[model samples]
Target: MGKSTLFNRLVGKRLALVDDQPGVTRDLREGAARLVDLRFTVIDTAGLEEATDESLQGRMRALTERAVDMADICLFLVDARAGVLPADQVFADILRRRARHVIVGANKVEGAAAEAGVLDAYGLGLGEPLRISAEHGEGMTDLYTALLPIIETLTPVDDEPETDVDAEEDPQGPMKPLQIAVVGRPNAGKSTLINKILGEDRLLTGPEAGITRDAISVTAEWGGREMRIFDTAGMRKKARVQEKLEKLSVSDGLRAVKFAEVVVVLLDAAIPFEQQDLRIADLAEREGRAVVVAVNKWDAEDNKQAKLNELREAFERLLPQLRGAPLVTVSALTGRGLDRLQAAVLKAHEVWNRRVATARLNQWLTGMLEAHPPPAPGGRRIKMRYMTQAKTRPPGFVVMCSHPDKVPESYSRYLVNGLREDFDMPGTPIRLTVRGQGDKNPYKNRKKSTPSRLRKHLGKGRADE
Candidate 1:
């Protein structure tokens, strides 16, 4: 009924300890909590305590302080039945002094026990308190309204908002073509793979490698899905690359990685998953592009099984960032495995470009919250309110919570991993952002009136004058 139960409700799990026992939670247990159209970092904290800088309790105090420091806002939960206690007053002071913002929640608010507490909670000085029954999900509408501001405030300034709004509004039948970039080290057969897929020497090819000098873009249709394919020059290690043309090609390839929805890393099957191959894969991952690995020239390999096993092991060791990535062996020379490779590429691209409707995301979020509620650390429950997809083309999402900054990296990974699994988005990079509710809207009013019409009217008036 209090922060404890609310934390449990948000995490969708029983991980956050909730019993009649107070102060059972000690350390911070972080998890993803979904609220309406947003996802947030839900931190389970041990209750706030007074401790010196050097004691064990002090360290715990410091940890809680850190969590508060990271949070965009604090969900200051109070037991409505008990009314506002001296402890809540002290913690509210601490939150006001240090936290960027604070939201007061009066938990266990089903009956008369909540009325006095809810009234007294206003004395915490965090503003009006929200009455809620975390156990029964009562007063959620008020909670949502109170949290809207915090969510809007935490959105990254550099993030591109309204990215697909226009497209969503369009009456057009489908979305635009996906942009995919094919990249690899020289002699990795990048050009060969692209040319073969297109059924023509759209890109110049030769027995000699590194023939492609520039990043060439070609539009192609596969499986009824339109795609813009970028065929890039072979990348050589920086020190070994002395030619100006090679340097330009490598730079171009790197740029393509940034813009690509999916990056196909082709490797020579005879020496797959080498250092360079790993480097290319890592680059794609860091750039947040969906990745697909193609082992080219597989038909030429004599010890196929051993080589395949070796490649798999190398992938595990060198490119764990691309876990569950689709790995296909193809002989660009023979067109073997070509269909599988194409299918994998398309699938990966689709995952990268995926967008979940807000309603569905909220439903999934509730399930998550019920499964793994946020823990209590420093005697306070971290509240996660909602989650939503903010962008695609690598499928990024934002979770609105009471404290966005307080979300731990491990918990972020947990959310990202969950998203990949639940959405069948393997091989794609997923980004999870925690935003405190009610972030400010940056939209400003522009002076309006059709400039041409206004000018004409003004001219007519002036002529009459």
Candidate 2:
């Protein structure tokens, strides 16, 4: 229907993937789009197709329907070249019943041949159809005209005087929402957990593995803070990911992890701490994102105490880089232990953003050096002068030393661990760099010259002279 093309044009970016194949877009992607002077959130949905309730296509259709219900106005597009088929009429009927406002668009009308199809759209009983060429950038003025009346009715007018200026301001104004990505291996119950958090079955979930093929984001509020949660597709080992679509899905999930401030690595309690799970956790840590390990399917586990002990031991042994990170147990099926998960997420985010003052950091460094001094390589004691925090968002530090290259990895690890313990900054990635005092000697290399004639004459005559 060229809906994605129009979506790209309005957003001024190719956010939604387009292809000659139908149903290329299987997810509802939302973007802030501008058309002339009107600005609104536009959702590009999957092409309407007929399928059963259990098939993959059926789930895609279900997601599209949910998008329609959430939208204020629906853009019902039809291919002017292909004309209105039975499927178009069926979808039009559904939209007429579901959407509050409908704007019928006959797309691909770049030539006179599409006139007959443009007329055919009127028979769907959606009022007059607006002929458009989304590819050629034509008929946008008409679209703006059609949307202006709706926008005016929807935007509220303020008549009362503002008494409390601060109260009138946006509550969540100063801070950006926390971006969280929920990632895990296949059948790890990632979607179910997110749906529970949202208090709606916004994401499709089932017993089947690899059902999700896109990284979907939904805005939510948890503990009086705004959050944008991403529900990513389940990842499998690279060797097992044979299909092209699955590869794309995994790539998308990895991209989400990179963009996120915090990542929740969901694990199946029945088979917790698998090799793939460790890989995912390590990836999040390496990417410098705060990580929280969530062991799901707790309701099914009979030996809770032993299982928890096993989980803790495995977490320590397998991924020591993320030591002391929050390990939460949850049951996405029954919404058990969700509060703890939320608390852990918030706490990890706080720790990730922690900044240590220079005074406190230098004091801590002094104590660390006094407790166990740096090693003397080749009988030369490496003098440790001072230390200061370079930046936050993982807490990076720079230390002035006699020789930066001589600082052993073991000593660096010790300092990092001490900093983590002293500052109460556990689980967050820490970076430590060593720098040497560069070239303090003024006359490093002076050219040798013969003595001056006056000095030679003043010197007493010798046999060699």
Candidate 3:
């Protein structure tokens, strides 16, 4: 009943969102769990709603059953207050049939009221019910004791590598998957596109407006490259996002964007450039994440050339910040243009982390300055002494100059666009900072104390001032 809460407790982070409302989790969210001495992977699944049809609940139940098949040990949680229901019995039977090992837990057994439910759990035929308060963190010792033997039997070696399920790949080891966050408005085929990439239906998808609530991450190898993809909830305009749940979902999507190295803004081909779409792309750019604009549902487009031109024109006119960013077209349903999308995402990440040598940067800066000199404000020239890259990953550069505050935004844009063109660093966000070198002399602005009258007289006598 408290699956997400228990998951957060075991993982020691609030990775999954929790609400009084059920079905907040639609995907299989995995986390590396640590319970005292035991460390293993734990999955938070959707509520077990019994539906065999292709409805959202049916899909969720299927996903949970798949997880059961994959999982080594299953933790079956039943609400202690509600006691064992018919649904709980159904789940118990399924677990007994499919699961390799199972532990029945009577969750929310915090006080005297849940005692009967705990007793009811004994009839579940899955051995003793571990009474645990996932919300209050009680009965954890019992949980730990129940899981230890299973873990010991399953674990290979203690000295082996401590690998986390969601670990970002290390360049020193195997190939590191590129981190990608796919975002857009409601029903933009974000999940559908990811499912195409994974070659399986991992994320729930249908005609519903916003089925996804959490920022769900899944790993895959696409187009001959490894990738850790995050499928976030659809974001809507602030005015339309009146519900608390919608607000939470939008905020969660924004968090996924921040964590991503590249954000793919999925646009419906029918409605390519909505106002909210521009805002989403701009948000990614402002956060310094590389952006890719992808138009989905291209297979249904009749006037493909006209639409492409229109999309291109609008992309440049509305989002100049993401100028030269990749605008790809793909049909998630038909799975067209996936290779191009993959290539574009990888290219954006490469540009985001691109670094230029200081020597090259200065050389380029000198040429730029000669070509278009800094403006003279009020007959006083703004002297730009030198420029050097301060950091990469959405490359950041600093210009040392005199009266740097006077550097106009227009001129800065000129330089940024110039860098993007010359260095082939398109699409990824670029940060340009102008700073004046501070005065070196410690007492340049001060009066040097004027050697107060008494001190001056003493200096005249002893020359010690």
| lDDT leader | 3
The TM-score values for the models, in the order shown, are 0.54, 0.88, 0.93
Q: Whose lDDT is higher: candidate 1's or candidate 2's? A: 2
Per-residue CA lDDT of model 1 for 193-269, tens digit only, reads 77787886555465666666556667778667788888877887778899655665678778888888889899887
Q: By lDDT, rank the candidates, best first.
A: 3, 2, 1
The lowest-lDDT stretch of 10 consecutive residues in candidate 3 is: 164-173
**Worst 10-residue stretch by lDDT in candidate 2?**
455-464
Q: Tell me, by TM-score, which candidate is best.
A: 3
The residue ranges of model 1 lying beyond 4 angstroms of the native Cα positions read 1-177, 223-226, 375-380, 438-465
CA error at residue 460 for candidate 1, angstroms: 61
Give candidate 3's TM-score: 0.93
**How close to the true structure is residue 447 of candidate 1, measured as C-alpha lDDT?**
59
RMSD of each: 29.5, 4.0, 3.7
Task: Name the regions of candidate 2 deviating beyond 4 angstroms.
Answer: 13-20, 24-27, 52-56, 108-119, 131-139, 156-164, 167-172, 441-443, 446-465
Poorest stretch of ten by lDDT in candidate 1: 17-26
Backbone N/Cα/C clashes per model: 51, 0, 0
Order the numbered candidates by TM-score, best leading.
3, 2, 1
Give the total clashing residue pairs for model 1.
51
